[model samples]
Target chain A: MSEPESDSISKGKDGLTIHTVSKDRLLEFMKDMKERGFNHLSLITGVDRRDYVEVVYHLHAMDRDEYVVVKTTTDNGVVPSMTSLWNSARWDEREQYDLMGIKFEGHENLKRIFLPENWVGHPLRKDYDLSNVQYINMDEDGEDYATFDQGDGW
Target chain B: MNNFVELNFGPQHPSTHGVLRLRAKLDGEIVRELEPIIGYLHRNAEKLCELTFYADNLIFFDRMDYVASMLMESGYLEAAEKILNIPPPERVLWIRVIMNELSRIASHLVWAGAFGLDLGMLTPFFYCFAQRDYILDVFTEVCGSRQETNYMSVGGVYQDLTPEMIEHIDAFLQSFPKKLEEIYRLFVKNDIFISRNKGIGVLSKETAIDYGVTGPMLRASGVNYDVRKANPYLVYDKVDFDVPISQKGDNLARFLVRFEEMRQSVRIIKQAITKIPDGPFFNPKAKKSMMIRLRGDGEYYARTESPKGEFGVYIVGDGGVKPYRVRVRSPSFKNLSVLPVLAKDQMISDLISISGTIDLVFGEVDR
Candidate 1:
């Protein structure tokens, strides 16, 4: 297999080569990288850049001992999931959805991960209101679970 | 055929280890599908670090993998140093290796004892803890804290190791092997232990990699991918030791892999202590200021082989006192992801054994 399109690739701040693929081409780019022996998808995280949410993929090629960072930006917070390509991306994508509000298309379970189901806003977003916090009532029943209150519990 | 019962294993049980709830779908005695419900111990570590100054967040790194705080601190500090382009002196690196290896042994001791307890053997728990206390004494003598030793700083470690600290470690190392043997004979050679663990929760080499399992769990599956050996950070490459691997991919295999790893850590500590050079522990330049500000926008990921697996830190600097973004790629988080796969089709009793072998520390997992 040939390398990812040269236009999609650039050097990152740490001197590791970073591939900034479009949201649509991410799965294909990841598959190609996996085929090229970048077998380990070490980390998957999202950074809320205000203008657009940036999803970062840290892939490690164990054979050649090379590290590559693949990042893609999404304005609408919808990006194709790489869970099909890498099993480790499953929880990571869910976490991104939970904390950064970056929706992963084709994710098997795209529900809230760390936060309670009743959480209103993604906490990691740059514009996330720290003052507009909600506390869950743990004593509530399962049917009435996580009743959000405007109290300063935390 | 449609009679599948859903069993909630734990959010409070002892075997689950630290507030982990597994919703297991069972067909009679065998589990069909197991989903791990985490986040009970979540403290939003990544988000919390972003709010704190670079130096101030080092203590929180200790809380991530509380069992092996030194290794976690080392990984975070290394990432910070990478972004700042600061290299710690040779003595600091060797001292870190000694501390990190001691932490490794301590972490593995906890795992060993817990694993034995999970397998219904109580004696090994006491044996392992006794040895672990000695290692903690060494940490206390050096860093002033036993478990949460926030000893590592951005440019270097917090304090220099004293002669008394070295002597304590030396004494521990001398007595550790015999204690380890007793535990080994009790757990490894025992027929009941083998019957409980061997060939149970067999995760194939391909499956382990596919699930991104690391450290002892991956090595137990016959993979030779160790962060210490693969990507050498700190003074790990300079230290001569073998990464023990087993092809069984079963509970027994994972147990043996970690059991051998404790010995390897001892070996590394011995060599690191003997070869530790006399020099400055922390970088003199960084010591001038309590707060460190990176000059430019940069991002770097640095990983160290923690006792559990590969503990990594990815930092994004916006040329500020505090990091723009800090993402911790905790090994337990990824390692715990494989539980559903490993637990599938296994007996309900064997689930405890499988989870024990994986060595799930909920602090890192839920982070």
Candidate 2:
């Protein structure tokens, strides 16, 4: 895929530029940023938009004093991962996978990061069924997350 | 290079600090490679954020970095306010600062205790706990919870502090410095302490920045970057305190940063307590209809310099009762990235010392 013009990108609130990149040019863009000294990939978080997936990479440039939020869209079935470029992306991808059912394609090791390995559905998805979900004991008081009904059922 | 042996450090071990295990590849006494295995204490904090309303999310935020829960609560509230376009009142901001600094002191006390225990010193841990117990009493009086205060909310703090609570804080603030001095006098110049920590686990400035290290760990590497001062969240811009930095970039440098940071935190608390005005704690006039309404349909990133480092809350609000999506940029996770590289050639015994210096709370790491 051909690289889009620079004007296509928009600036984020925290001074990060939001670039819409295709899967083919994503690696090239990441490499360009790394060469420009965005050596630290601060965070990789996913958002589920029902019809599509939005993967945001919070990258920081220590030498240049800049940060950019690189975002890419994927179809519901295809959640492209950036673990190959940044090792720290591994955990974030696993977290995205565990909660939003987004698969980190090139992750060397990806599993349920914060939830049980056998959880039925992505709990963060809009259509997640809470009624049938089993409770997770989180604290010393044995607070089961499943039993506590989210009053609005959203 | 005859063989490489595998060593398993526990999910239950004392030094692991609350359900964190690492399977290390060892070549004699030197570590060949290290794989951190987490999730024993994972509570799915982000998922829980999606399931509940924003107001109720404060309680869960407290659990993220339970040792410094007040900071996490503040981060969440700050992010929520950004989305709602609401600035907390001056009194609320002062209260938030007071609670946050106290939490920092409390967290450092525990860290000092645990770090000493890991380094084979028992007395410091006891001394730290005694000091921490008194601080927890102050926390419990204000928020009704000792460890996890959950005192922060969207528009402001949960409630106004009583005069008695202010008196208690005043007394604690006065005595805390003396107790800190006593601890410092006991261990700061101790020959054995210096030998164990100084020149151990030396992380260079270049590598520290490359690994995205923050908080005391990064400050110790001579980085003057502090989110509170550099970015100035809440009322930190108005507060007068020094950002302590060390050029040594060793375990001792990290240790010294924590010590100095505690003193600075106390200084901040003193100013906030003395200057805080008698006004409405929360913006009681935040139109009743606006309580559940999320005003914006965009994303906001709210980052705060917690005791542990940069605790950030990234939220995508969709003008709904619940946040569209919530992502926590936990400092521990970022700090842990530098571990394998840091541990590449260090002796096995130095591993715990290095780990303790970084102060990775598993709750935040695994969240």
Candidate 3:
């Protein structure tokens, strides 16, 4: 289901227009875009929406010299994956899983990317803990530091 | 169908390039499929940029492309300057050019050394470092910090380049071209080197650009897209140098492009040194008060031709001392994007040669 050519999609930063498309039609949208010459998938980043998680795909069409931002949001637990369309989305989605706790369904080998498999809690979450967590001293001294409370909740 | 053996190349192995881990399935010596596992060395560089002041962001920028720290620093500094609407003086731009060129030479030298070492030659590593140490020494003289230099401030440099330091750079530039020829003659023509690199891991122009591959890797594919040329920044337009391109797009071609790039850097420096105008360094209008003023708010993308590729800095300001959001579009990340596609159907032995040709510093790739 291709949107009409005359219809201008949602416009965001840098004059980039955000287009909303149904998950079922994503692959067709991508193929239609390729036919129209949007060949470059510049960046694939994820943003956290309180009730759900959103995935943003930034595609730059070399032929048109314009950028289009396509967004896909998933329900709280359902992971709507788009790896089949853009292979580059695989790692970017895995990273979203690791940091924002958003899983990508149908990701061939989805796993923790930027964080250790044993790490607890998604650090990038707004409610993620900043205190009482272990931190490594990268510079000198070679000390491992943590801010865990030793007494009753103060 | 089930003849392939699965091999986990690295999470810690030396040849995998940085902390990168790859799971490859091979049929005899030929790689059937390869999955790149990255983010081992991630430090959330983007998030770190948001926490620091606009001027202080250079400190972290250097570490992203550790091989070409000056280019990364200059890229960020130029972007911040653009957002603030402040133009650094002529001398500062010249200094930025000189430092950037020197860093390019240093980065290529390290790449040469590491590539040689990867291919089982030890002499080039030592020889490359011997020259690299001199560049580091020059960096220490001007910036007072060698590797991690927050030297390039938003409107200008940390300090002036002393005449003595300029003489040292001039002397090095004069002798460096000869050393470059010597290294090339020793390494490039070697039979084993030729055999290892001749036709290994080929990437086409369409794939390279689609993956947003920049710098030498893209140039090796016969695509003449150098940010310095297509997107000129920081006085790159005033000076002249040819962007060497190769059609092979193989491991050897990538190596050749860097070799020519180092030579081009020298040419640019020679011209820059002769024509460098004498003037003040930093912009006086730049906020020098205890509380730095970030007067305007806007998003700016400044990309420079880093030794590795096009290192881009995307900054979002809120008219405050600190950036509201900062995103670093690292070349290594985009360069590594094509690895899985390229590595498929190649031999396991060719993996190192292929990865070496890309020359990704994990600090930038995983950052």
TM-score of 2: 0.89
Tens-place lDDT per residue, model 1, B239-326, is: 8999999998999888888889988999999999899999898887677464555442589888888888888888988888888899
Task: Name the docking class for model 2.
Answer: acceptable
Better candidate number, 2 or 3, judged by lDDT: 2
lDDT of 3 by residue, B1-367 (tens): 8987998988888776688898889899988888788877888777676667776677788888887898888988767887777789889998999999999999999999999988998888888888888899999998888887677887778788877888898999888889888888878779999999988889998877667777899889998778788767778999989999999999989989999998999999888888888888788876457226655476565667888887766666777777755667777877887898788888777888888888879998888
On TM-score, the stronger of 1 and 3 is 1
DockQ of candidate 3, scored on C-alphas against the true complex (2 decimals): 0.30
User: Cα lDDT of model 2 overall?
Assistant: 0.81
Chain A only: give the TM-score of model 3: 0.72
Local accuracy of candidate 2 as per-residue lDDT tens digits, B163-184: 9999999999889899998887
Candidate lDDT (C-alpha), each: 0.85, 0.81, 0.77
Flag regions of model 2 displaced more than 4 Å. A1-7, A11-17, A76-87, A115-122, A134-154, B285-296
DockQ order of candidates, best first? Answer: 1, 2, 3
